[model samples]
Target: MSENNCIQYINCHCYMTIQSLQIKARMFSRISLISLIMIPVIWSQDWQVQYSSMMKCALKGSNTHLSGSYKHPNHLTMIKTFWIVNPVKGEETINLVDHPDYKGRVQYSQNKDGIFFLSLSNVTHKDEGMYCLRIVAKEDKYLFFPGIDLKVTELRVEIPEEAVEGKSSILFCKTTCHLSDKTNFTWFKNSKRLSESNVSDQLLLPSVSTDDTGNYSCAVTDHKHLSSPAVTLSVRYPPKSVSVSISPSEIVEGDSVTLICSSDSNPPALNFSWFKENQSSAVGCGQSFIISSFNSSHSGRYYCEAQNKYGSQRSASVSLTSAGDQKAVLYAAAAIGAMLICICIFIVVKKNIRKTGDAGGQSGVSKQEENNSTAVTDQTSAKPPKPADLNESVYASITHSRPREQQRDGDEDEVQYATVQHHRNTRNTTAEDGCQNGNSVSAGSNTEKADDSNVIYSSIKSS
Candidate 1:
């Protein structure tokens, strides 16, 4: 009995396999039959009491049944039968029904064919023992040697001593006795089922974190109400989701400033570090850093690191500035704006100047025209223009006083001629383009030729 589990026995520290235990169940016993009113041991053939099994295991808080069959000689009448536990070889003991320890928890059934069954309900660790059957016939008794061994076990949620975050760990639902491979195990967390038969032996927890902390328990599938005692699952590591906040969001020169770091972790993070945007090393270390008087040297983006026994994490960066630096930035922006405005105004003024120069050239041309008109007025003649046709006829009449006798000869018909100064016609030229020329027509109705003494008359008309 050394190859199997044996924690159920109080004195025995070893266990035997089912095959070996069954062989052991058939131990030698002195069983005899006797007639009524004649108490004497009568040798008889060996009795046959066969059990379904000799070694049995069950989960705590569950029930187990032990069944067996018996055969005896035809001459004896069966009186009574019962079951006992951890009994002496020949000494009589209390049956399971009357035993103080098994009150209200034991049941027995027997058929007329000499077969019987023993049922143990709500089995517990204290109930672990060797059980045997007894039969009484005509005041003589017999003890069935060897017996069934019963063991009770429960599930446990087992974990490693140092479970860490972001790491894998296997948690076992264990029992001291090995149940059949077909037996199913159930896992629970805070009264909620996590898995069934598929993950009965162990639960694989990956990337453990603080959020995974909780109470865990397990039970055999059929004995679900008898779940194992709750075991707490805790995960530990460095800080996470680290972040920094700057008090008084707007920074000003000579103003006090504070940077505070925060994170989520188990057992709390105790170390912290502050760093500038481009610097390779930390500027300070603690939960918070304070600057009594801000300046340009501290005006840069910064972040912090949070650390614990497990590891460390860095926070998001923030920026800081002084009042003087802010004002300088504003001044430079204003100067650029003013310079752009001036350039735009200059371009507009240049365009207007070009337009004025073009208009002035047109006015100058009009003034030159006025000057030409005035010159023409100064030299214009006061007479209208004469007809310009050369074919127009000029007629003249002349008279001559004849001597006494020549008068009688008709000399009065002598021809007369006169000179004419011609003027241009207005129909063709307005006095030589809008002004009269100095030349004029000067002929009188009765004019004397400079070479003739007698007066002559002439007139000109366009035909």
Candidate 2:
């Protein structure tokens, strides 16, 4: 061949080879794309299944539905199965299907839309384990589907044994997992269904009494389980009827008194405290509290409280008063009695002096009395002045009486006259003979007689 023809032929041959290589690359790319579209993509066995953490089974029910979706292509047929593996038995697989080795039942179904559904029936705790689904196609190899961890939860509830009256009580009804779906929680009291509210953690009792106390329980069901643990509700609080009594109903100031606080309640009393109205500090405690000396400070409305673990109860108030008025009355009575005694003593002494003529006539007489008596009795013998006129004569005698020293000197002679005058006055006699002698002579005679008699009496008594 010519040199130019040879070069053109080589170039044409190289171009044909390049075109063949391009066609082959396109064919390989088409095949790879077809394979990618047709082959079932096996998800990792670590695929996660979305479900509630808590799975509960009824005692008599046959099936618990579990739902999930395969992550692979829709054309792939997924086969799901559940295995009850005993970890204690060296991971021994216990078939949960219609197999005789299984103690529970497990069934599965795939919808036309490729959604997978599973049912576990008569399941126990041993039936709970890791579940896996395998997917395969007519033209491709088998691939592992997602895995679901199954947990069997039991119902549980807790409540306090007792709650205080008029207080809020928490009734706990919780599931092993938070129920995200529709759930119903019901409370029962003594077998009667209680009205339940949503989103409330406490059973608020605005005011509770004895009638509100009873056995209580809670049941939580999420279209799955029912009947939780039962709890006893005991409402305890301070006594209802409280009263206080004072030892002396009538309290008096300066007198010691005791106040008693009493009430009826459960959970025996812890303390008894007394308080006065509007006072911040408590007075005392115990059934009886003593006031050393009741005073105005102690007076006022007083009340007491009986307290216990449950709560405190208050007693009715008792009024206290001071005894100042009553004491004053008693003091006045005492003063009157003393004054009467003094008056009586004065009267007795005065009468005795007049009867015995103890007062010396000279010193006992007044000057005005002596002047009047002298004027009236001048015409008379002045024979110690008749007693009927003694009133006047006594005045004269008083007027003529001597000084204390002179009277002492004349007392010996005047004593008899004074006695005669006293006797005449007692007899109410006006005759001058009543006295019989002149005043001085009579006085001397009576004075000697009186001295002799006194001496005789003294001698006899001593003997």
Candidate 3:
């Protein structure tokens, strides 16, 4: 061979070696990647099987199961031959074949892929124990899985023995199972859900009252399990909405009255008292106060108080009045009216008497004038009588009894005269005066006309 041909052969040989190295390297990389992926999968399956051996908690009177498995793809031919159950305390070991008594309660199944499961129906506290599984292969070899512990749990609620009305209270929800942080709690009152959202395990009440008294229960949202039974909360409180009720609302004096004190309380009211307006002390003590004969003394604003061991409350005040007082006021008003009427009558009578006296005086004066006009008087008239001596004077008796004649005289001017009797001096026709002559005389005089005058006199001498 020539030098170039030898060089070409050497290049071809080197190219073939390089190509073979590349192919081998690529294959090795593919295999390494596949191996890396398989190692983790295998490791995860082993981890799951090992983790399944840990203790498990389940609620009593509920269905539960224990599961076991061998390495994933490699153990495809593996089969669960039997199941063993170990109880917590006694030497009672249970197997699938030997425990005929547990045939109905215990269930076992193994998948074609080597996944094994054991289920217990209506699990009770007595079923708490460790469970183990046995795997059998076609090689006549057996693989014993680690034991798994089974724990029975129960839900319970804890609350205070007693709660006070208008006071804060707390209730707690608990369970025997180990709960995760994501677990949510729910509360129910009288079998009614309080809220739709998840809440804390503890229930807090800012204030409680008689309305809050009911059956309360709690449950876990994740487990969909409730507490065994509901608990009843008792709220103790004082009297509330106190009031006083009176029978025969329309009251009258001298009538019997009944008063009742009413209040709402938890334990019931032990004492009741009645009070009147403006008084600080109670007037009576009892749930019912009776007034045998109500009178003005009982007419006033009244209220009642109800009390118990916890506290006391006062009722609204009510007013009462007697009818006798109204009647008395009316009678007094009538008496005052009568006295006023009498006073008015006296004033009217006094005014009338004064008017009558003035009229009578005027009438009496007119009557006296009329009597004088009808009267007639006669007396001896001596015209121009000189001074007469006592011996020469003569006295005569004169009388006129006809009043009609005196009035009939057309020229007569009626003159009224009183009768006079006198003795005059002899020188004087009139005899001067009776007293001067020292003689008693009677005389009368009347004038019929302006120029005519008639006078009459009568005289008597003293012995």
Q: After superposition, how far is residue 25 of candidate 3 from its true place, in Å?
A: 59
CA displacement after TM-score superposition, residue 224 of candidate 2 (Å): 8.9
lDDT (C-alpha) at residue 180 in model 2: 35
List TM-score per model, in order. Answer: 0.56, 0.39, 0.49
Instruction: State the number of backbone clashes in model 2.
Output: 11
Clashes of each: 2, 11, 28
lDDT of 1 by residue, 1-463 (tens): 5534445562353334655666665442212223211111212364566766677788888898887777777777889889989987456688899999999999998778756999999889999888877788985887765667788888788987867988987788888887778877788889999855454678788878777788888887777898888899889878999998888877878889999999997769999999998899989999999998988788899899999999999988987777678778889999999999999999999999987985686467556655665565544434333645331323322222232333334444445444443333334433334334564333332231232322334532211
Stretches off by above 4 angstroms in model 2 are: 1-63, 71-94, 98-104, 134-146, 158-162, 196-211, 221-225, 242-263, 272-305, 309-463
Better of 1 and 3 by TM-score: 1
Q: Tell me the lDDT of candidate 2.
A: 0.57
| CA RMSD, predictions in order | 23.6, 25.5, 26.8
lDDT of 3 at 354: 74
Off by over 4 Å in 3: 1-54, 68-80, 87-93, 96-105, 109-115, 134-146, 177-182, 209-211, 222-228, 248-256, 321-463
Query: Predictions ranked by TM-score, top down?
Result: 1, 3, 2
Candidate 3, RMSD to the unseen true structure: 26.8
